[model samples]
Target: DAGVTQSPTHLIKTRGQQVTLRCSPKSGHDTVSWYQQALGQGPQFIFQYYEEEERQRGNFPDRFSGHQFPNYSSELNVNALLLGDSALYLCASSLFGTLAGGQETQYFGPGTRLLVL
Candidate 1:
């Protein structure tokens, strides 16, 4: 009955560096989504994973990608990072195709804040 969770709550990197953030989906959830939230903006969708494959992606560049594991856990990998990549990276979990009132329900994990210095 574990909840959605992330690791290494905070991170620091420099330009051109590569970083990988981890996420463990909530118990019984099979889909995982990654979002990036800036200082004062709503979260921007990064990508989503289901069935151990990337099923959907946002408008981010090729540098951003992720993977879903058989255990339903996930990872967000950002390569060639820039200062603009600094943000609170959030991980949200849902039941993939199960919708309530025409909307999918998601459980979000406390984000891993990334700072590109």
Candidate 2:
């Protein structure tokens, strides 16, 4: 019955470095999505994974990638990171079927704070 959980509550990296964030979905949830929230900006969708496959992606560049495991946990990896990548990375979980009707509510993790210098 636990809600979504993310690792590394905070991180610090230099430009061009790489970082990986992790997440564990809530019980009964089968889909995982990643989002990036820059300071003062709303969260931007990065990608979503289901059935251990990427189901959808957002406007993010190829540097942003993710993977879903059989247990429904997920990981978000950012490569060649830039200063702009500094933000709060959030992980969300929800039932895929509920999304079809546009009524699904995603439960979000506390988020990992990334600071790129």
Candidate 3:
């Protein structure tokens, strides 16, 4: 029962550059969501993918995008990064289905810490 996992515990990028982080969902789960957590702030949803399509997304810009593969794994790509993009990128997993607002229990990974220059 491997839980959700993310890569490059830490990453460094410069303004205008791009980066891609990966994630593998927990066992028996099919939905993957990406989040951004700044210092001392709660996680902000970026988007969610189920059945290989984006199902929901927050207020993030087009610079932030993602993909989910047949293996239930995911990747988050951020292009033209900015200093504000320096934050922890978190990947969470939930059961395959519609989650009720404020009721879904999301299992989060340790996160990929990104630092932008």
Q: Per-residue lDDT tens digits of candidate 2, residues 7-114?
A: 999999999999999999999999899999999999999999989998889999999988899999999999999999999999999888754633267999999999
For each candidate, the alpha-carbon lDDT, in order, equals: 0.91, 0.92, 0.92
Ten residues in sequence with the least summed lDDT for candidate 3: 96-105
Listed in order, each prediction's TM-score against the native is: 0.94, 0.94, 0.95
- Pairs clashing in candidate 3? none
Deviation from native of the Cα of residue 35 in model 2, angstroms: 0.4
> What is the per-residue lDDT of model 1 for residues 30-65, given as tens digits with 9 covering 90 to 100?
889999999999999998898998888889999998
Tens-digit lDDT string for candidate 3 (1-117): 888999979999999999999999888888899999999999999999988999889999999999999998999999999999999999999886544642257899999999999
Better of 1 and 3 by TM-score: 3
Q: How would you order the candidates by lDDT, starting with the best?
A: 2, 3, 1
Q: Which residue ranges in model 3 land beyond 4 Å of their true spot?
A: 102-104
Candidate 1: residue 67 Cα off by (Å) = 0.8
Name the TM-score of candidate 1. 0.94
| Residue 62 local lDDT, model 1 | 94
Clashing pairs in 1: none
